[model samples]
Target: MTVKMTRLRNGIVIVLLIEFVLALLGYIFISSKTSLVLATYIFIKNIIMLALIFYASSLINENNISVSEVLNDEAKNAFIFGGLGLIKYDKNRNISWTSDLFTEMKINIVGKKLLEWQPLLASLFEDDDIKVVDINSRKFEVYNSKESRMLYLKDVSDYIEISKEFEDQQICVAYITVDNYDESIEQADEQTAASIQSTSRQVILDWAKDNGVVLKRYKSDGYIAVFNERTYRKQVEDKFKILDIFKEQAEQLGQVMTLSIGIGRGSNILRELDELAFSALSLAYSRGGDQATVKSNDEPIRYFGGNSESYEKSNMIRARVIAQTLAGIIKKSDNVLIMGHKQSDFDSFGASIAMYAMCKAYGKKTYIIIDYDSLEEKTKTVATNLCDDERYRGVFISPLRAQELNMSNTLLVIVDNHKPSLAIDSNILDIVSNKVVIDHHRRGEEFVELPLLTYLEPAASSTVELIVELFEYQKEEICVTEREATIMYTGMLIDTNYFRTRVGTRTFQAAAKLKELQANVGEAYKYLEDDYDTTLTKLSITQTAYRYGEGILIAFGKLDKIYSRTLLAKAGNELLGISGVKAVFIVGKTGKEEISISARSTRDINVQLIMEKLGGGGHFSMAACQLEMEDVTRAINLLEEAVNMYLDERKSE
Candidate 1:
């Protein structure tokens, strides 16, 4: 819009100037007469030209307000193209300009009389480093060496005055939450919890009032405050220290507190500010939470933390509600479609099948979206058999087929992963807005908004366990059939390394529930049974693995179609168990598909951060990423460097 307006204004100026010249030349040639006649003709021509210029200028100015207003708010492209200017004003009623790229230009509104205006104009020239090319009683044009174009008279005075109205609009809201409050409270007795809450509230409210702000308690641990820039800046030149004050206050109260802060500005457009604040708070949480941070669109993130412990309780009740909601959605929808990450593994495929069974129990039309031709032979066999069953006839289909059949009423159950980009048939997501995510991985960005339900427990071993827990919560002990229970049990076994890794009370309880449902635990182990050839291949690949850093392991090998991811996880875990090993990483070429990398770590290290550097993230103890790097050696070298850097940073810290 700004570009178009600029072009239109320039075009009109050039056309008018051309017409003025043509008129003058024509008048001179046709009316060469007495002096009075010639003078009158020149006067009329000048007046007409002046009127045209004013009218043209007015038209441009008339559109400038709306154009500037829209560009300020709705111009998403302004970040790439220059955005509209924001007029600013000081407390003393002085006007200024602001933009990320545009410099502030202050113009003095001078003079009660014609002569008095000269001194004000001269002072503006001297102070602003601008030069006045011409000055008249009611108009002036100024030029600056730092920028192009002459400043128009009305823009300097009238526009600047109008911009002052934005001064009082500076009162802002800061949204803050105490991170890990549930865990903190749970760790303490009732009296201690009350004391801590009272202490925190007083500290926050007192600080807010002292800083000339009003603190409004929203939720139990959340607050919104009104702040002015003047008061906020006076409190902290380096505003990051505000978080330190919170930490100090919490320490003095004999407790720990971590704050997630979101600062909002812009009066008329509070929603944008709210979004920015929410995004900032989310980033703070993702970076392990417990800090006060400011997020202005122009400012870089300012984090403050002492690397404190962050352990919030997983929302088990919410997960149960989500499951019940998902069950209802499947019953109502025309079809239930489930998908998982690409290069489906035991957990992914197993979880998908489990969800399919749950939907089937409700007599809903269901399909498991898969890359049939590209999937592993074993998986294809299971999927084919399920489709061949009379009950599941016309249910199983390729991701491409599912995309065509999906509609708004279709219920999508994205399993084993929440990241939209990682899901099979990600594009199909848009067709069905009614969706649920049953994932056990830690939350990451890129989740679909407004999901009908989401059951994500980062602490849970697998989506299969979440499903099992959901059944227990619903008290539907007999809803899952023997076959479905076996599948769910298989997923839990694969994810937990047959109850050897990440096994907890809930894990054993889930297994017991499956057992009660008549699931053949021994038959579930049959799914884990591998042929001697595949076992030998994994063993040989493990023999080739090399140690990197204290705990990380690296190996490159081609394996038979089976035991690629399973072997990778096994190899990584095997390395991690070795003496003095803190973490492990295994990379391999599974099939003609992309290179696969798996990472594992103990409590002493966070392998998730390492993989996040490679555009992947999971639990701190386990993670994986797939890159398009065809050269395996180069990838290994890069991964080694990443591991070394992470280890070195931990040591230094």
Candidate 2:
């Protein structure tokens, strides 16, 4: 209610009380006749006063004018006693009557529109107390009176500043570890190893000092750092430059060094912070290291500094341990079911068959799950050849048949892909209690949550190479059949682009072992040969290729015929063979609703990262993704945009 209306109502009540008191005094002191006359006069006065109050209320309601304005200073004392400040505003929200307190505060509100006070109003609405500066600055508890169109503010800045300071002092914890420390030191002489370790420690300490973080080395290769919320935000804003600094220092020592950093923040409990840090650390390592990962109590994982190539670790000992473990798992199970990603390629099919052969050697019944409808031509050809042989009858089964045969003791092994959504039969994974994942792709956001065992090596050329290593370490003497050797050889051949890209010492070793087993290279080549029509189609597609960004080529068009993934990959690889082309991206439709992209690079660009942005992943040099987009042009545009964005980011780095 307006101050004027409230005061008018109080005045009417006071007048009535005064009338009653006078009537009582007259009746007690005067004669009967004179008292009656005084009473009649009092009744008439009361009626007139009530009529005047009602008329005044109607006028105030119609004009929105406070009674204090109509009778200025009549209720000023009441307003002061109630600790209320009143200011009248015209229809334009221009101030008219400004209180003395506002004037004393040097708040020149009169004759100014309400819009001019938005800054003060915004601050007032955003917090319990707001700082206002006219000629002098102070904080206030703000209140708004809509009926009177007035603002009231009471000072309260000191308390807010103290609360903000306390919030800024919250603690955050981080853990850092030198990835590949063992391999780096083992390859160097004792003196050089000592130098590397010393340099690494000094670099970390210097970084901590520069960032105002308290550091403590808890292990030879691990350190824990504590930071305040303010410093943590600064670190995040800088994108954790310490990771890049460590990489540079390690390279200076003639060693490849990478750090995996995990940070925990936004939690009051130390135990929760520790758990978050551990989770972040695991995520950083799983994404191939050389990065800083942060996980607050409620936020998803955030990453930085993963631009460098992943270092290949020596996995001889680890491979041996895994081989022994897998053998044990296989022996315990009644039957083994092996499958790979949907639309199985050479790498996926070869890895499955290799596992099948290994399980058979242990005298365990094994089934190779094959979805024939989705199989590529080369994979189908291989499957047919293996089925015709007398030794491999009844080895192949459909997804439905596999489900029926699935038992609690059965072991499920996934190869060439780790994402459950991309599995040939994702349902089987849910039904089986025992599951193992083996893939060579860099870990993505979508992956199997918990597997009995995981053999993920992003540095390896292909999943088949890892399987070949396992074969060498298996306790039982297993003979590699010619078919088995050929398929494995073919897998290596395709994934490495005929050993021209992503070829490492271990990759060559796996190939040499396969050759030693008399794997027929000519047969593998025969399966990869394209028909005349396919060759022409690839050539036509190649003609559509155009330079995109720096050293990047993009070939985009709809296919004249539905070409298999093998042919598309060949097209991309052929584009990379052109001089001055560092990378090639081929985008086209293989089916009505499926658009496939085959990315190839020549050690200059990381195509895997590009494909990963588009929901696919593979080796740094070779990667591919399939989108549900039906428009070939739209898919091409998205691919080009992704490639350009990657190139720009690298340039900035």
Candidate 3:
């Protein structure tokens, strides 16, 4: 109540108190007739005063509710009772019954309450001599003292949510085998090794049996399991610690097991399932082994524990293997077709030519697919010079012609890229059953799988080095034309920025070999030169570069008809020249078809992680993706946030 209203109520009570005091005093001392009249007047006035106080307190207390505020609408509805004073609250008979001189009618407000304290009518009486009664069956309680009158408020609320029902669904099957099991065992004594293997096998069998899963023993070293969702959940939550279990059990056995798990979900198509399972196993091994990974229909790809130490690959062995692989490809396929990523750059195109020359050495019919007019004039001049020669007449074909020549007898050789979607002629991929993917880029999500062979070394500067390594391993004096050698060298120089990035012992060796093959260094350097306008364009765009966390971002407002991915790929490397930047992202306006985004990172950051958020993924260091967004500004904003988030997370860690 307002202070004014409270004051008015206080004034009326005080007046009543004074009148009662005067009348009581007169009744004891004055004449009997006068005293009786005065007592009756005070009694009526006291009754009227009590009624007014009740009206005021009841109205204020009811309007101001504390309990209703605590209870939600759903809870409030459940509290309303019928008007018969027989309010039922479940099976409990805890309600207290009482009676008063006034009617005992019960009221329930079926809405939220906002009262902070309960009101008492006794507080309205100004006279300390006033009395009140609380009547209970078989008992009489009197409120004769003002100190006993008090009110208190408290909040009470609790709720439970309904859970969704679970259905019986098919479960995916996953199996694990330690990659270095044999080596770890061989290091142990005969008795110790035997005991370790036996104990480990028993532990796996017992765990599977207790979970009601069926296990099939494969080669005494690999065990396959079958399970559904209920079983799988138990396995992840319970059996993920199986490695720790094995560690404890085999402590005295003198050996440890490093596990690699492979999982596949679908059952009807065993071939596809087998391929997927193998891929999962490969991924697990790549992750340094020793973990569990679950695969199902929901995940088109596999899952593995990331950040594993990769297996060390020897350069000589890699080169030898690739040479043999190339020879086998020539032996199996009748024709060899080579191509690169779209809007082929000097490196991509040069790598294709190198692969084509290698194929030609095997007396195999080879076709180099390219868009001659789309390249820079220097690149176009070089390609035109090579194509005009009679020896290269049947070798150079347009993308359309390459698409038409698709056949099962042909081998599709994809260089500088592993992503089929970014290929020059993806249709060629669909037509040729046999394929070889040689790339320097890190593996991405949409990389072409099911290849006859694939050599993906992210550490290499360019695919040209891959071809050079293959040629070196062959040890045969295969004649490479001046133009082919220069093209390959130009591509290597472009990707490596003149031996600046990821160029190691092998890169230098390959460069030496290319130079020995009479590659014109001056001509290749000329191919990298750009006009004054293009240089100004690059510099102008770079001025907008800004720091985000440890990374840098820049957007190209204007770019020519050339492919933006190639341009940003160049720009991303350029941005990395700025100090303190571990990663860089370049966004540019391409044609109406797509917005180009290129991301590059040093060892401390993974640009692919940011790109993957936009439905694109690439290697840990350098990656490019096309945003389908029509608005370039919106795409850039989203990319900026992504880059910042990635760097922030890295910093926090």
Best by TM-score: 2
CA displacement after TM-score superposition, residue 426 of candidate 3 (Å):
1.7
Question: Cα deviation of 569 in candidate 1 (Å)?
Answer: 2.5
Residues 348-421 of candidate 2 have per-residue lDDT tens digits of: 99999889878988999999899988887788888887898876798888999998984869999999998888
How do all models score by TM-score?
0.62, 0.79, 0.59
> Candidate 3, which segments miss by more than 4 Å at Cα?
1-276, 283-294, 302-312, 373-378, 406-408, 558-564, 644-653
Shift in Å, residue 46, candidate 2? 24
Give the alpha carbon lDDT tens digit for every residue of 152-251 in model 3.
2111111111111132245456666754456557677888778767887888888787878778878657877766656766555554556556555765
Instruction: Find the 10 residues in a row with the least total lDDT in model 2.
Output: 127-136
RMSD (Cα, Å) for all candidates, in order, is 15.6, 7.7, 19.4
lDDT, model 3, position 238: 54
Clashing pairs in 3: 64-115, 65-113, 65-114, 65-115, 66-114, 66-115, 68-112, 68-113, 69-113
lDDT of 2 at 339: 90
Candidate 1 lDDT over residue span 382-429, tens digit each:
556666667667766788888788475788889988887887777887
Which lDDT values do the candidates have, in the order given?
0.66, 0.82, 0.65
- After aligning candidate 3 to the native by TM-score, how far in Å is the CA of 75 from where it should be? 25
**TM-score leaderboard ranking:** 2, 1, 3
Question: How much is 512 displaced in model 2, in angstroms?
Answer: 1.6
- Model 1 quality (TM-score): 0.62
Number of residue pairs clashing in candidate 3, backbone atoms closer than 3 angstroms, sequence gap of 3 or more or interchain: 9
